[model samples]
Target: EKHLVLLRDGRTLIGFLRSIDQFANLVLHQTVERIHVGKKYGDIPRGIFVVRGENVVLLGEIDLEKESDTPLQQVSIEEILEEQRVEQQAKQESEKLKVQALKERGLSVPRADTLDEY
Candidate 1:
């Protein structure tokens, strides 16, 4: 059976009803978030309290959606080779920029003295 708890603040939490006492108190876990309480019930108190099943709005069983199990397309070898080539070109350009920046700072490397050798 579903469990329900009424906060003195007029909010209700719905879950698998666990247990209740003669004092109209309740204990429940796996609770859903709060629902509005009617002003007719007066202001809810600050402490936890049990709500009667008859008083509950009875939002039916929760439904969770399942994920699709479709497989992703396999990458081709040509695509992988092209990606590697692009990465290597980027690295070479970055090294060239670094050498140019060092030269501007008066920190020349002898090995990088000739653009043709680079």
Candidate 2:
């Protein structure tokens, strides 16, 4: 069965469902992560996976018809990865400024997860 899996850390995997246990642990065959950035996306081949249940945020059957209707443009993996890196860097710079401004005003700002942790 074709399946789409979302990871807690914001990654998406599309593959064939191979097996699952009572705990929701899964084995996926011919897996690849579909990464979306803005109106574009790319697929990074990942092969087989034994996904731990805790890491899965969502799982659903892929609707072939609906999937084909998506408006997002597909790009080469290399290009998309580069775009993602640039986007992340920009976010980090913005966050740094926000954190610094908060500190200057004697405001304590809670730190979010690391910029690259996901």
RMSD of each: 24.3, 3.4
Model 1: residues with Cα > 4 Å off, grouped in runs: 1-74, 110-118
The lowest-lDDT stretch of 10 consecutive residues in candidate 2 is 109-118
Candidate 2 TM-score, C-alpha based: 0.91
- lDDT (0 to 1) per candidate: 0.51, 0.93
lDDT of 1 by residue, 2-106 (tens): 544555544556566566566544555555543222211111222433465455444343332321232433244455445546667998999899989999999
Cα lDDT tens digits for candidate 2, 12-64: 99999999988889999999999889999999999998899999899999987
Per-residue lDDT, model 2, residue 42, is 99
In candidate 2, clashing pairs total 0
Pairs with steric clashes in candidate 2: none
Q: Residue 88 deviation, candidate 1, in Å?
A: 0.5
